[model samples]
Target: MEAERLRVRKDNSLLRKREPIPFTRESNYSTPVRPPDNDELPGEKKGLPWPVLLFLVTLVVPWILPIGPLRLSAYRIVLVVMVLPCLFMWLTGKVGRIRLTDIVVLSFCVWVFLSLIMVNGLSSSIEPSGIMFIETFGSYLLARCYIRGPDDFYNTVRALFLTNLFLFPFSLIEFVLGYNILHDMFSAILPTFNYPPMAARLGLSRVQSVFDHPILFGIFTGSTLALVHLVLGHGDNIARRFTRTAIVGTLAMMSLSGGPIQALAAQVFIIAWDSALKFLKSRWQIFLSLLALATIATEILAKRSLLEIMIATFTFDPLSYWFRRLIWSYGWASVLNHPFFGVGLERWERPDWMPPSIDNIWLYYAVHHGLPAAGLLLLAVAFAIWAACSAKALDSRLCAYRMGFIATLMAFFLTGWTVHYWGAAHCLFLFLMGSGAWMLERKANTGIELKTDTIKRIPSSHQRPSPHRNAFTRRILSETKLQISRKELPVLNPKGKVADLLP
Candidate 1:
């Protein structure tokens, strides 16, 4: 009886062990495992493609030389290099599918070409139109194709941070000495415009760094600050994050542009909000409430005109308000007259006292490209916002980064209302859009791959069993039945009597 009880216990243990095998095997094959933290998943190779590397080099070139030979900008030279290789790659069918955002950008470029031709005539508009198309649409396409995933995105952030760091000493020298060494060096080699001496504001000389104007330098620093913050927020090393943040902040202050100050303030607010309310159930509700409060404040200040109030509050110059007001008045009139395709790239008719260049980006676009092109630009921005909001990646840190990026975009748009960003400055906006589009595309591809894997794993109803498996199962059942019958049959013991061994 004792031996029999031990045998029964052994059998029960064996059965329990056997039962877990199938469950474990099923789970191993059926359920996907989450990747270990900080480790990239298999098959995702790191490193930027050559085109992306070229783009990064392009961004850095203007800072190094500011201008190239024959009065061409550094960006123009890089664009030529990028376009040729991209065209060859596309012709060879090596490029990915053309996204909707790409199409929209191309369409806007086409409209610009047609409008220029209509206004300036084909012969006169050819060079300007071609340059516009290449600079805007071509750059966007190159960015869209080059940035493939989060790795690329992070690499870009790192590159920008390094670029800012590299330019910091130059900026400091300019600030202290009231001279730009880079400008002087580049001017010697290339024919360049003679800019006025650095003007003192708030008891310090405004530093233009390597950029053409103080405002542009400030804008670049401000934009880089946002990206650095995003990377710092997601980074693991505390010392490195703080160091980068300090460098970016110092550069921003050196630029002495109100835009960077305002942008940095927005970034600080975002970081505070993230820290305080990130875990809250209705964090977005809190954000909306804050926005409502701001709107109410704006309404209360409307009696004095919000523009005047903003100028008084954020800017050092009081005359800026009257200046912008004049631009707006004339720009609106021009838009009203040529509301459709614009006045065909013609200059706005304003009094000689008024500035020729419109400071507002939206007004500039409307005056140059017409309301339709402006509308398309807004639509593209809207799409990018949607894509950023919708992107979901395997790395959990991506959500916070995306939100930070969106906040930066909002800040840029608001600050851009006071300044017209052209040339390379415009590329920053395009790069942001391309990054968001890449995230959305990656999310979509991941979903499709998951679905494909699932379809491949599931057995089809029409699939027949393999002959070997069928034969093996039948043989096992027959052997089990034979053993049971043998156990149930009567057996003769030493007493020569029929004895049943079943018990």
Candidate 2:
């Protein structure tokens, strides 16, 4: 028994006090180190500086650039080239993973395709452009997938607000300077007039800002301005808040596309929307400011003989009051004539006979796609809204985007009564709303909220063993390398240490 115990002690000593192996250049093949924290590395964070910058820049180009035959509209062109290619890449898995929102949007687009195919069979002019609308929406849905988290979302919202901020200065300048700037700016490219009478006559010509037309400008800016106020609220600083309030309010007002009465009323509605959305303390402040704006607008309109101004400004025909009603009647008649698979997208407009009289968007849908198409479209819209409202309430950044998107839609809904600008921006906003919905659904599925920063813990593979950093691991790897160089591992001495083995 004593001999066996001595033998065991000797074996334990051999194991505990193994001699160190001599170092070589090859000894550098060491164990890999891992970071202690599970947080995602900075390199992994998504950076979209260029795309976001270009996107924001595109939104305001309409106001700053000269409009003519040759000057390319950046806003329209980006949608075709940048948006389409990116979308295709996403669908094919060449780009990042497409989110659930993208799938939903694509499904809806497929529905549009099937419907449009039927439209084309029925009416030849209902060409592929109608289908392309769904395609555009799909692109936006995919574009948003690149947005990784809350910071990305906040960046987008900031870009949106800053882009829209240009409206304040542009409209204000137009309102104060009247026709002088407009005539001078357009004179080089546009047909020069002797006196530029149209400019002076129109009194700021309802300056469309960056948008293509006055009415579109009014609606777009009005909606966004209202949305900003709604999200930001009237905070502590009275001066800054009121200044923004005045600028946006004035822009909406000076946009005389609504003439005097409608302009005043739209501003009131904008204020009311903002007031309704504000916190209790700020709510009263907004309400009082809104009342002041109303009083001022009313006084101005009364003095200017607003009703006469409106009559004169809007008088596009001999029996002006009846003309819109007459056109709408014709529009309804057209819808009745082609109820199912209505007039094709290209077929609906005839600039020669009359300047595309189907101004009402709801009616326009009915006229273009029939009751089934219109009904399906409305149902999709209703679902999107319900989804947005029912989903988790967004943070301030997301709130701005959501409110901006919805407000823009509402503006379109109202503007459809008079004009049609729902081609690109309309689809963009829809896709964004859908994407937002998808984000919420994803959050729910993960059983996590946006604010959480927990990193996903991927299990290490069998081939990649658990990171044990014992001397054997380093010794084995180094000896393996040296053996590859010298053609075999060095023989070990009876002491079981490579160092003890000499040549």
Candidate 3:
């Protein structure tokens, strides 16, 4: 009775025991998994963003096309290659995921649209204004993409710099060979301008590159070069640094371009001002000093004898100076007559009481766009100033580039006394616009609190450590087998009694 009771107790205890849990074998080595993000926007789906695309297009296209008198084939190529692609992508909702910069750019564009409509109705001749709107605004839109990052800002300036650098050798060759690339583009008043009558007289000489005219070439080169140095500074790049030095030396030796000289001087003033503003505490004092320096520089440049000496060393074209004087007088006259809007865009002729400037940028602005349009241009300048200041507030490298670009723009504005400077006028100005937009974009991305609309956590693939276990569980089957092998009971009996497995 006692043995049966003990057996029953053991059976009950065995029955109440919990079943063993399964164990998975694991090694020390593990390969990490980095899953792809599905939430990426359409624009970022592929390589190369939108802004760079636009910059290359506007810059290159106008140089290629055969629009009326302007055979802008090369320029057209740039537009086709760079700008159109970006515009197409943007229109198709493939780039720019509704950025704040887009909104800002769009707002300014809307203003231009309104101005275009107003000018189309108000102008005496509608064609010029209409053409101007299409070309200028299109250029603006294309250039707008470059304003997003410091890399873009620097790269755009670098590209502009290289284009001019490449044009320099061709210009020198054109001067030597007397083969005018822009011959068909212009109605040349003087064919023998390059071959002077006596003693290789370099006076009143203009050197044309592949551009529309010699003066246009000088203006474009001077303006672009100024912009390059203004934004980029005299850096260590072998190609650019050497190219700039050579061009400046050659221009100085030739002394044919007045616009470039004035531009260079103005650029110096701007650089000095930039340096001063950073170190000097008093803002008004800096401005006063800048004004004084600029006036002094102008007065010094005005002396004909000194000008001749300066140009004799490098040979800057003298025709640009006379051209500038004529334009300045005309610009002042236009300002006096119709100070408000000046003429209206591309309205070169005088309106009854209004006087007209030959090729003054300010005059161009006042006449073509009127005061409001001009104000918008000023706003553009203000935006550029804001961008420069803002860039200065960030890291030092960006600050240097921003300062250089700002100074370059200022130089161009000051040099606007001379040739029409259409290329430099728009390109450099638009560059600043892009830079400003870039800064704003950067600032917004970092500073502004972007609220998350939704949250979803994907599983991370990090392996968690296994829980602790006793060694006895691992050897349970082996121990059970050993006990069965050492049995101490009979295998079979008449009474049919079960035997113990262990001794």
Ranking by TM-score: 1, 3, 2
Model 3 TM-score on a 0 to 1 scale:
0.56
Point out where model 1 deviates above 4 Å. Answer: 1-28, 31-45, 60-71, 84-97, 189-193, 304-308, 443-503
User: For candidate 3, lDDT tens digit of each residue in 1-503?
Assistant: 69657755764554445543222222111212111221122123343235454454334222333557544443344443555655675566553444444444444445545555564554443445434443454455565543445555555666655666655654565566554444433324222123222212353335654444444555455544544554455435768655664564364323355556666666656656666667666764668687677667756786544333333333343563554455555665655665544444545543445444455555566555455545555566555556556542344445566566666666556555444555533543554454444444333112111122222222243122111111322232232222222332112112223323232
lDDT of 1 by residue, 1-503 (tens): 69657755664554444222211232112222333322342114576566666665555444333433234566666776777676565445465566566667777778878777777789877777777777777677677667665666777677767778878888888888787876777667665555677668877778875566787777776776656766544655877776787888788778676666766776767777876886896886789798777767887866555555554566667676677778888998998988877777577868888868887777787887788777777677766677677776435566656766676676667666777777667766666666655666543211100121212232343244333333332333333222234333332333333344334
Of candidates 3 and 2, the better by lDDT: 2
Which number leads on TM-score? 1
Error of 3 at 297 (Å): 14
| lDDT digits (tens) for residues 161-279 of candidate 2 | 55557556656676666543543564455443243222332434556544555555555555445444543432326676555555565665565654322433444564566547766
RMSD of 3: 19.0
C-alpha TM-score for every candidate:
0.75, 0.55, 0.56
Q: Model 1: what TM-score?
A: 0.75
Error of 1 at 426 (Å): 1.5
Question: Poorest 10 consecutive residues of model 2 by lDDT?
Answer: 444-453
lDDT of 2: 0.48
Q: For residue 360, give model 3's deviation from the true position in Å.
A: 0.9
Q: Of 1 and 2, which scores higher on lDDT?
A: 1
